[model samples]
Target chain A: MIGSWMTLPLVLVAAPPPPLDPDPRASPPAAAVEADPKAEVPPLPLRDARRAEQAPPPDVMRAADNPRVPKAKPGPPFYDAADEAVFRARFDLTKDPAPPPRTVRMRCLVADPLCGITVEVQALSAYALRAQQGSVATANARTWHSARAQYDVWVQFPAVVRTIGRTRFNVLSMGPKGGIVASDGGDLWANVGLAMRAFFGKGAFAPHLEVTGALAFRIGGFTEGGAGFFGAGRTDLGPVRSPVGFAMDIGVGLGGFGSLVIGGQYDSPLAREEVPESLRTPAAGMFYVGFRGNILWGAPAAAAVTTHVLAGRLVVPER
Target chain B: MRAGVRPLRGRAGVGYRVHAVVILPLASVLLVASLASPAAGSEAEAPPRTNRYLEAPPSSAPAGEDFGPFFTGPPASETSFVKAPRRGSGLAPRLSVRDGLFCFVEDAHCVASLLASTDVGIGMAIIGENGPDLPYAQLTFRGGFSLRPVTLYRKRYHPWALGLTASYSVGTGGIRLQAEDVVETARTQATRIALVNQLWLWHRPHAFHLDASIGAVRSGVLGRDERIHDLWGTHVELALGFGGWASLVVSGDFLDEDTRIVFGFRTHALAGVPVAGLTALGLWAGGVL
Candidate 1:
């Protein structure tokens, strides 16, 4: 009899219920956390309120747009606030998100070099990077197919400029205008020449001045161009004064702003000819040390593809 | 072979020619400098912001483009400073037809020719512009091949070609100059060799391809007097391309008294014949290859 009763209970458990509503419905789905790429999100206003006592209702959090999870009572944080503060301190830009970024670090992120989209994320990450600066995220630059315009550069912050020599940048920034960071965004001696790779990989035209000297030898009977910034250090105009010489040069180039340049030339006496005729001298080409800034303006050689990626870490415990 | 015109009687102290090197250029540069603001203070402090914060992540890519983890950045709008200008170049052989307007400033003459390719090519400078000098210096066409056995520097895909150009010419430029005509005839049958460097400079706004070359050209000429002299000289050419198919070329043969500069500033179709139909001091049209 006891066995039959147990069997009867088992049968009861196995029996299926009568049909009710045909459609299935979720009890309360959670909202996804992601920002739209094209969402013109208004700035999150700064709040200086004290920590709240009550946590937000779970239902409200699950349904509300632009929801904010209330903070727990002021107790020791889940992790070291000081350590997080130090990490945050490491990043100057992790401050309030107003129109113009406050911290110089954030300024660079918003202005040149780093993309501004991740400022909020970076703000949160300032705390997480405390342990692993290595986990930092990076984006690659677009590729330049043209060789002429593919000069890239990474300018160190606070560039050092000197006379007739030396070179240097901060964070893949094409600090062509020297390392000086201006609020209005202009630099002196803007960095240029000698390409440095960008965060994203693509090459940016440098705005810095570049001076170069190159030796050219004609194959069998090699020759060079004459009279301009684009010209070498020789002039072979014509017969009576076919003055040829070794080239000495001082050239200056403007990077991204405008690819303008001036190259001065002075051929070694080894190339200048002084062939004198009876009463008159052939036009031996005036200005034995001629310089060419002939190239007034040249179009930007390559395309600039600005690539920005949003990646970083934020630490929080499950409610 | 040719003679010289005495530098204008008595007044010759580096006159107008000096303008090409000094004076005007200096004045122009100064004018530009006067208009420009002195370089702003070197170390720029971030703009003084009374209220500054991160503007939202521009919501999307700073430029207007669909977002993918990795894709080409935004296309520059018409007003954007950056642009995309592709340099047009290929392995396809260019069949160029050219006309050389020789001694336009001094003799008012021209030559016509046709040439094709990096390998075997030919040119004929047989066209005439003004008639006064054709009879004295009839034109000739020549053909040959480029012995470009090596390349100097190549980046990405653009190659710097160091070529050995060799050719043979059989034509007439035997001059019969009168006491009054200030003309130097370049008529000869000669062997030519040149070192040619074809470099593509920039690829934006308009592509600028530069064909800079220097070479030796030797010609054996028998004058009307039955006297023979081997004309020897070297020349250089600068061809800057503003298009994928056309370039503004300025070329001249040096070591010759009657050297005339050839200028080709004509437009061209990337797939069609490239021609430079105008002349300054040399020929109206340069090589048509």
Candidate 2:
């Protein structure tokens, strides 16, 4: 009796069995057998199915709008459609064949020794295109690349100065109306030079030759009709005149890493001066020792201008 | 392999985060405490007292009859010259002891300078060396002139002064032995003199002074067989002054391609005394000179 009770509890805990299938030979109901074949089957859209299969993956489509997708993968930086379009236009990626060669034009303004401005242009032939297009045609075409050199010249203007030098004369008997007179005028002066430089190790040495010229004028007058004129002689003088003279100079500059320049210039006068027996004049062969230094505010050989201060002393050559 | 490496890195990251959290606050607290204590002490020592009469008595009263003459009445105005009434008179002689390390551009070794200045008047310095037994010893006599006269501190004209200095240095050094085997001992002596005529323009606000100097210098070096004379050169110096009258001067002297640097300190002491003291302590530290 206890075994029977346990079997009953076990049967209650188990699930019910599934129903058996109907036999094939069994007939169906009249209404179900009479259903139409056209109503039962739905038509498939072939074009839509094919298009869906050929489309890009869903992740790729999603990534087109998602920025985080690019950060997850290591590759070139991602660009939006507008940025990509701009880059494509700038680089001109659509061109099939090579474009014409580019023209390079250069212009320079050099100052030092002399002030000058220069412009250059040049034409370069496309070597590859020579097989397809004749040289004559390429030369005549305005669309071709070219470079040229032109407008090379130097312009210099004289620095003007007006100054007086010391005069020596003994004081003598003079009338109340006696006075001294002096005159000064402008002179044109210019210096022209060329330098060849060589740099080695930590030092730069340049050998240069320079030519200098000056146009000068001076006028002076002495007291006339002094008190002693009746007793002795009349004291009177006229203005003295002088002409311009050209000078030639040669020098070499020794420079180092720092903007240090030391040079010596020898100058020889092209003309001699005529002076009275009682007057003293400077000798012809006068040389000047010059030293210049620059503390450049920027990098060397750059376009930035440098400030340089120069000091010179003129030494008279021994007669 | 990946699983094992992952936990190690995770634990290391956690450890770093913990260390950062613990160290930052502790370091900040210590820094704040260190900076605040000195400021607090300075404030406590000079508390702002509203009772002018009671607070003024301790500093102004005479402890004895001799001190009675020293007490002048409260200054008539902020710019009044209560410290020293007379100008140009009651100028105290200054004595200074200076010591510092020095280097030269021409030499690899560094030397020390111990010197003193005895002031006969304003803008005058008499210096002599007293350091370790060096290769040379020098005696220098120097004097300077102020373009603007010295006035009492509070009544002084906008802290502007210009000056010129001239110095003469005489010294003797040991004979430098050459490679030659013969011991040729000669008079190891030299006389170096420099005349630095400068114009100094200075402007001051409170205890701070900014100064600039430009001048011409003439220096000469006389040796046994050679003499180098610099007829003319350029000198410039920029200086800053702080703490009432203590100043730091940085000077550069250019002679041809050579340059010299001079660094020094100037101090003014004994503020209320009749003869105030001026001291210059430091060195003409470096460069070719």
Candidate 3:
């Protein structure tokens, strides 16, 4: 009789009535849970669980988007603030969405072997950023190419001065200026020039080709016309003794701020008909030893902020 | 050769001579000292595939595409792409300060050639004559390009690399005349051209390197009254790269009328600060012990 009773309960469990509604969204009957409070709920399938995680409740989504809604309690972070800072610091500028900012500075320009200084305003044009808008993100991120145009004015003091032919001069003074035997004569000149700088590997270094057209004025001593600061006097008032010439110098310099530039300068025909035959210096070539100094100007801060935002947006939690 | 035009013997003076002597030995010592140390990047370990310029693709990089420091393709861009300039395309300039004895038969002068590397492996130099006659007398350009197809990283894939170099120079023919004094007939150009075959043996990331070039040259500049005097000669050079930034060079040109020997040191000046610092550090650490 007891066996018959157990069989009768098993038959009842097997012959349970079907659910009225066949929708997957319907909640499960609570009878089973009520009967066995300790029973574990079955886990969802991988695909369904992923879908559930991706698609939050409408109310929850709205609350998350609302600024006034209070945020959930804080959880443990995958990476520390220091790691994020490092990541931000190392972000490459070539990968930025915006075009890289150019550099501008006021520098002191002094070509050594010559005792003269000038203030110059220099601007460096950024390389064109050709981001593939429609391309894959990986492909867009891989393009790290760069180049720029570095332009500046070459201005000097005292005015332009005429130099002598066959008379060589050092950085300080001219041996003999325009046949006038001044003990120590200096050069007074100004130039407008352009430099094309091509960068290699993250713009840490570059090689540049610079060309300039210069106008040199004449300086006069008590007796004759010369070119110098003290030994020679002013002669810019006289009949256009200023010579127009051109110079080409190829060199390598470190950065926009401070650098050492060493190259050869070819000065082509300073004067021909203006000066006397004894003072005519058609062509002169000299070694260029230049130092560029950026004293007060600081680098642009936009790159850092852009990189920080980029790093934050791109950060992924550690697995 | 023209009259009243004399090649100034030891024209650079004693100060330049002293500087050349001091710099050469100091460079040698530094080179040897750096070579005795450990290689660079040993302290900071990198992931397998980080360096994009390596011959072999980094672990994370795509396979089968060409990658190197100097030899590579243009970047893929969705929009119109302006290709970036490559190295050795006259972008990274190499400057060498040469102080040597430029001799012709019995007469010799101390000359300085501030040579700058320019377009496509050619080095264009202005030979400055630190004399009473003229500031610069000649325009000399010479350089070599490697024939090897591969750009190796760290160490050279092959120890031997063959190259071809050409040298040409034009200047005054031992003549010291004012630019205005010389008429079109009195003006003369001294010209020299040579084709050299260079053999190089180097182990990069280390300091030891040796190269030898041999070639035939035609050098002359003997036209005073519109009379050209050109002659055939042989040119030879042997260079030893000691310091990571400098090299010791010994070159000779043997002609019928003018035979000369040049012994000098060549150093490099890089453009950027970070590059200079990193190169120094890398050379110091990666020096061959």
Overall local distance difference test of candidate 3 = 0.28
What's the DockQ for every one of the candidates?
0.02, 0.01, 0.01
Best-to-worst ranking by DockQ = 1, 3, 2
Ranked candidates, highest lDDT first:
3, 1, 2
Compared with the true structure, what per-residue lDDT tens digits does model 3 show for residues A1-319?
1232233222112211233233455454598668886655554556665655565322211222334444334233334334444545687422323332222112112222111222233322222121111123344322222221122322222122222221111112111001000000112122223333322222322222233332222221111221111112232111112233333334344433444444332334433353334334434333334443232242312222222223223322121
Pairs clashing in candidate 2? Answer: A120-A148, A121-A147, A121-A148, A121-A149, A122-A146, A122-A147, A122-A148, A123-A146, A123-A147
Tell me each candidate's RMSD, in Å, in order.
29.4, 42.4, 31.0
Instruction: Specify the highest-TM-score model's number.
Output: 3
Q: Which prediction has more favorable lDDT, 1 or 3?
A: 3
lDDT against the true structure, each candidate: 0.23, 0.22, 0.28
List the candidates' TM-scores in order: 0.23, 0.19, 0.26
Ranked by DockQ, the better of candidates 1 and 2 is 1
lDDT of 3 by residue, B1-289 (tens): 2343322211111111112322343344335434532212221331132222222212221221221211123122211111111111111111211111110000001111121111101111111231122211222234333432232322112334445545443222232234434311111122233332322232211123565777776644334333334556677767664322233456665754344444333332111112222222322232200
Interface alpha-carbon RMSD, every candidate = 27.4, 43.7, 32.4
- lDDT over C-alpha atoms for residue A261 of model 1: 29
TM-score of 2: 0.19
Q: Estimate, for each residue in A1-319, the C-alpha lDDT of model 1 and write its tens digit.
A: 1232223222222112223232233222222124344434333223311112132312101111211323223334432344445645677645322232211232221222222111100000000011101111343212211100011112122222121111112223222110000000000001112122123211233333433322211001111221111112132111111112212222232222332323222211212222112211121111111111111122221111000001101112111
Candidate No. with top DockQ: 1
